[model samples]
Target: MMPQTTEMADKLDVLDRGSDGEQRSQPDVTAQSSKVSPLDVLKTDLPAGLVVFLVALPLCLGIALASGAPLFSGLIAGIVGGLVIPLISRAPLSVSGPAAGLAAIVFTGISALGSFSVFALAVVIAGVMQLVLGVLRAGGIAHYFPSSVIKGMLTAIGVLLILKQLPHAIGLDVEEFGAMSFQVGKENTFSLIARALEVIQPGAAIISVGCVALLVFWDKVPALKKLTWLPGPLVAVLGGTLANELFQRNYQTVALQSEHLVRLPSTDGAGGLLGALHLPDWSAITRADVWTLAVTLAVVASLETLLNLEAVDRIDPWRRKSPPNREMLAQGMGNLTSGLLGGLPITSVVVRSSAGVNAGGRTKAVALFHGLFLMLAVLFMAPLLTRIPLACLAAILLTTGYKLAKPKLFSDMYRLGWSQFTPFMVTVLAIVLTDLLKGVAIGLAVGLAFVLRESMSRVYEVSREGQLVTIRLNKEAFFFSRGKLVSLFEELPRDTHVILDAEAAPFVDHDVADAIRDFQSSAGLRNIQVEVRGLKLAPVAPG
Candidate 1:
């Protein structure tokens, strides 16, 4: 949802200029009027849709793995997000899909609840909540969530992703019987790391390491650098496929088995495409945890959608703004459809939406086409998709995790000072130790405390130079600040001259006025000189 636009104008400027670097007017998209044909739109949006499909394909697979969900769930989310949202949403260029950020939440939710079906029900509930939010026109709700707390949620998820994917990377995802029965979160994340190291699969480890290296240096390769239409993930998957083929041909002993690769159920069976249905358990709805999970999903997904929509607008070449309530309603329907059809929770993903824009997609057709591509892939490409090794997917997630919680993010938060840093750090630690909802609650309380302190602190300014002191009232001073006022006078040095300046203040509470008057009258006890500038105390009540 965090759509990045740093230096985007410079990158997009070349597209607006001619070969000679002379500027030209932007195309009048409506010049052709309503007469624009489907074929023309397909021609314009198809290639861009293909680009988005390539970009979204591997991510869907990888995010499903990261979330401990059936791989088809990811594709289902992609299809619904792509196909459904664009039909109703005013955000023409925003691409909705399964998000990397939600992986941690899904994994923990399933583990705590001990059932994917139950989790699916939670997703359905979340969709309903989003629909209600839309109906209430609560599009402005995103403004209420503190950015520091949100950043903390994401940073913790990054840490969780790295921890969660490590075992998969090393081919040590041996689930103990009933492990999901009591599993919760990163409390055991490191323990899994230790276990993965003990029984590492050489083939998977080698492939994963190589894939990570390739991703790290992908743009450095001269030929690959120019292939802007080709996504790095697709390249990594292709490389892994080729490497597996080489192993199959020559290294029989270490060739990765079927268990190490993607396990998409074949579409040619008696059930055909419908055979992959992993429907929700309706009985789980009565559980309190399920309700809690639903609320969390609804809130998080809504925030992500709103933020990504805003981000997409900033980078849109056409400079269009999306209607937030309509987008929310669209997301609600998308998630509702996805949940009913055995899919992961869906959100408007910044990465895919921004990628669509970068790939020259300017209309809703691109999103629709991308969804159709996902649906088709599941119907026909299951055989080829099953050959993709888990290690390569692991590498994709590792890169994603690294980017989400980069080292620079840490230093940047610290530089924002304690007001921002305290909540961010607290949220990170709490989420890592606990679950998403609990941690965010703790962080929000801390953030709100800081906000309250700041509000109070803003009412006055205190400065002292040697023996001279100044108390500057800013706009207003109330009863809550009387303790602060009294405390300030108590700190006076002997024979100090004090100036209580109220020129800027239009209203001073009677409590504050009384406190100032009492302080002024008693200053002679400490040989302190008290002068009130442009100030009048309230009339004292007769005793």
Candidate 2:
């Protein structure tokens, strides 16, 4: 292998520049690492924690409800992700908790496994799988995903968020979680809008609209955006909460109660938070259903984590990168701890991760602060949290979703070239029509097919100057290209000076080498003078 040149290293430094808006020399998000002061990390982490907490609070409950798990289980995951994972994680800024990606798996596990205890067994096993994957250094697979496809996936999720949460924001409830197609009661965005107009829950709708408007205005208004310390989402949620509180106080509008409230699990006291921790049931581990669900959870959770990690790194204000394998280990530990304590499955979340970065969080310490805040909220302000309206939570998610599927997202992907655009577009459509995993599967299949097509068409261009014939093979020189080499040799004119240059080729398969040697022997009869070049430049023989 060639040693990295000084120029290359300088180029890399330029790519890693913080807040400099320079293009990175390498596109791989996980390949680089950097350093920071402990105090700076702590300072940034505190506000990041607050922002993530605000974003994560509603998501935890919604994902738990979607997954058919007890609502408290979601909080358990959030707490574990915030408090436990940060302590163990190699990546400082990332926040972990109940993942939206695992909702389908959780739904299946509870329905088939028959009990939450059985499902807990699966969560534990999935943790083990993730830990092993980290050990195997399989996180490199994330690098293979085309950037356009990732952008598409994130954007599509954003679009879906708007479609899914719009109903909730308008004070219309979907009996199921984020209704994919919108069939049951008041299904679809159109119907929800009509319902919002007809049976107007004036208080909830008014507050939600106000929250969205405030969020939009805050970002667009020059002076408000300058208030960097104040996070827009936090302000939106708080404003909505205050709106509901004031409306109820004067009897100007109907009080928003259980139907619209953010329900925190009722505990007798401070002890209730501790008592909520669930332990794994050993007997449940023996069931085959447990193993199946565990595998499912691990696969889904890992995918979501990998995807979020990529997004977080992309949006990092510092342009700092995370080691994927190390991230896997941290998440694995988080899941293992959360499951043992009867929490939901956890993964890195984009919204919370973004909140951390935007809030000036420089390290994992901010995540810890967020967890502490959640614990305090549960212990001291549980009743206050109840007064917060679901619409407000809906508003937060709507903003998240909108950002994910923003129009500029599509435009950016389209400009990146077909290799990225096709798979990304496919991923977006597939996820919209199906679920996350299946959609990714379809995208991967398309991506793989493109790879294979490029592989098979690997070409070697040859130029004839007088009696000399010079050949330059593409990067890929392998057994698969043997037939092409043979055809090329057969077509070449005899009694010519020939040079085979494999220097540009990183690899030359054994079969290809054999084919080359055979071609040389055969050419001797035709009086063709043949020479191989570039092989000596490498430390060892080309593979």
Candidate 3:
């Protein structure tokens, strides 16, 4: 991964210079990068799909249980996300399914509706809303979110995952298992952590610690990196499962228990796939709750799909950018189909997508293969797969969570300034306290507040020893700061000499233009002499 990052940078450097017309080197080693053929794509995709299948297996069951849905609903969603997306998607590689982020929402909805059928209805409505969003081509609205906020969101997700999984990773099942809290109810993460310190499940804890260490070491080991043909998660999950079995057999210690099992519904044959059907709530369409859920689902699912698409493309050796709008349509179709079949709503998942890419997946064929594997697993390996411990899944999630919440991620955000850190930290807190959507809303609100506050603060007067008063826009001025601009104009004393110097303004928004237009029209009323500098009058676009 480290070498790959450097390689990407070098590729970007060369790609940026195409316009220079400078004397170039020989026929392209890099141009060949774009020569990925149908056969090559298929070969890469099939193995990649298998890798995704392994990772997705545990996740599908876990997420379905977390969402208060039938276990098979998750698998159904996974199959649809993996199988149907290739038809409409422009994304070279993206594996979609039930998301951890949406679990809380599903839980809340199920609790309120009092039935999985009602929740499925909500999902269907959400799918329709997403289809409408695709028709409107509003998927690009995600671009309006600042890069800083997005980074903060990703970082927050990482921290939340770490906190949520820590208890499970360390073998402590408290009141809140998959929780993200410094504190919650009478006890929080720290309290449970304190308990973990006192009464460690010596056997389970040891296995988890060993699993984490092995995964970390495997990533750093060079020789093993070549054997990267086998994904790190795959090794860790399989190894942990086997280790649990050995521990039970040898030491009479079992970390693998019924509560921690991936329960597969009992069935005689392949017919079980057809037996695992969920019907939607036909009456839910008339309810306001369904409408609300539809909007939320569409928004969250679309955002996840777009972000995952971006991340997958970044990891692609070929660096192909996915079309966001087209991907949105595919997701809508996938969700619709899945919901119809009594399955959970599907979205592009980073976990399996990363697994697929790491396993040398080059095309959508990998996703299709994964779906095929998932369908076949029910017929062949259902009983065996059911034996895999939930602790093993926790280990995989723990490893993934650590990568998100690494120390460097925090340092990077802090270095970016308060404008970045405020949203970033708030996002973490929000995810911990509430759920994903509410957390994101709170963080976004903070970011917007930061913008507005900075805009207002730019109005402070500067003392210049001259007849002319130099009005300077502050370092962080945006269009939303126009009220400050207007207020400054209003506060200017009669007959004052003034210079409006916007050279210091890093950004000028439409409100600034409006304020300027208002000032120019009313300059005579104030009896103030004003001179402007660095005023680029290009009309600002409405966001």
Candidate 4:
């Protein structure tokens, strides 16, 4: 027999080769097939679902509060987003819910439409529009957005999260969490913070700071990393709840009131759940303003969904690319269901998706489980959920926000040079100053300007050796490049042999070709020799 070491080495070599062969054979397996067995779902997705449920609960309520809609409406949207959208979406890791980005739109739409029920009708109409958009394959528009702008959008959202959550973290809970727009009501983001400072609660402040500290420690300490089964956010919530109880019992002066905690509508049974579902006002269907709001919702919701889908796909460990059109169809169906149920409009949300991903969610089962958890909590655990403090949730979001807008992100963008950094900074500033869609538009415009400048600069190449000037045209010359071509002709040295080469160019615009012809015609007057080749000009139009 061989020596023990040699025998073990041989076995290892065989195992290594087998591993390599498996990897090579299944290179596309993750993208092509994302289905998980029930056993796998129970082991991995259940825990992930619980984590997402914890994150989604507070956000759902907060977004509804920010939108000026009934709190139950947000839960309805979250439920539908979790239950319906994942069934149709091709993205395995993406989670859908009520979006903070649409809070301002919903707030304004409700006022314009006269009632929440009427706004629900607009949401239904928007859902139909999304279905039409999916049918028309408009989801491909997401591919046109620049990477810089998308990164900026994510970073800006992070900054907004930190700013918005500060008040809640410090126990100054007047405005809701998740409002990203610079201005909300009589107070803007800064004004709200200023107001919160005037009535800050010391107990809430202590709890929030302690929760943040725990989260930071848990994230950094390797010893704590081993206890991954218990999510840090959940622990923070528990700690905050216990701390609040102690404060109420002992430090009565600084105790957090009921207003400072989650307040899910308590329901008795199936009847209560059914009774909570609100229906849209069918009479509002004929109103022109309803249609206008519907169109706006459809456009904005679709765009947000597509953007989040792209962002989530990029971060997915499997690197699977989602079909954008299918995602739109899923979101459309989800919105339709939500609107019919008196829920807020739904979109694929970055925060919930990020939480799911961080929790090791690998299949749509995670979303399904989270939805079930939401339903169960509303039905059974509403009282317990209410005990959790807003400060704890704020701490969780603070960590998330820090992840998104880390200082390294800015440094990385700067390293990419101004072409990337300019649009990124502009997008962040614009979103912070204005809103999401407008900010993205501004970034897109800036990105397009850079594209045009680059295109114009590369129209042609000019070289002169010993007075022999050669103007070699690029692959295509457009009207935008005509001025440069004309300038080149005028600047050529007198009596020099000038060669205008177009043989390499695939196509030349009519205006540019005309300019070239005029230059050739004028060369004789200047006593200059001109050689032209390979420019097949378009036939002149008859007058």
Give the worst 10-residue stretch by lDDT in candidate 3: 17-26
Please provide, for model 4 over 181-244, each residue's C-alpha lDDT reduced to its tens digit, 9 standing for 90 to 100: 7887787888888877887888778999998898888767767644545656667778989999
Q: Name the weakest run of 10 consecutive residues (lDDT summed) in model 4.
A: 15-24
- TM-score between candidate 4 and the true structure: 0.87
Clashing pairs in 1: none
The local lDDT score (0 to 100) that residue 294 gets in candidate 1 is 94
On the 0 to 100 scale, the lDDT of residue 111 in model 3 is 86
Top candidate when judged by lDDT against the true structure = 4
How high is each candidate's TM-score? 0.68, 0.79, 0.79, 0.87
Point out the higher-scoring one by TM-score: 1 or 3: 3
Runs in model 3 deviating more than 4 A are 1-48, 111-114, 173-199, 281-289, 307-319, 357-362, 453-466, 470-479, 490-495, 498-543
* Candidate 4: pairs in clash: none
Identify the candidate with maximal TM-score: 4
Per-residue CA lDDT of model 3 for 1-543, tens digit only, reads 112345545655564211011223322233225455565655456656776787687678777876778888988888888778777887777888888777877778888877888778888878877888888897787676655555555556566666666666666654333343344557766677677667666656766777778877877887865453465666766787788778778876655565455566666675766776778879777888877877788888888677656646644555567878888888888888888888888888766765676555766777888888887786788877776665555666666666656676677679889898888888777866665656767887898888778657755456555556677775656666676668777877777787887787677677676677668657778787766678756443554
Sort by lDDT, best first: what order? 4, 1, 2, 3
Model 4, position 154, has a per-residue lDDT of: 80
| Higher-scoring candidate on lDDT, 1 or 4 | 4
Question: In model 1, which range of ten residues has the least summed lDDT?
Answer: 175-184
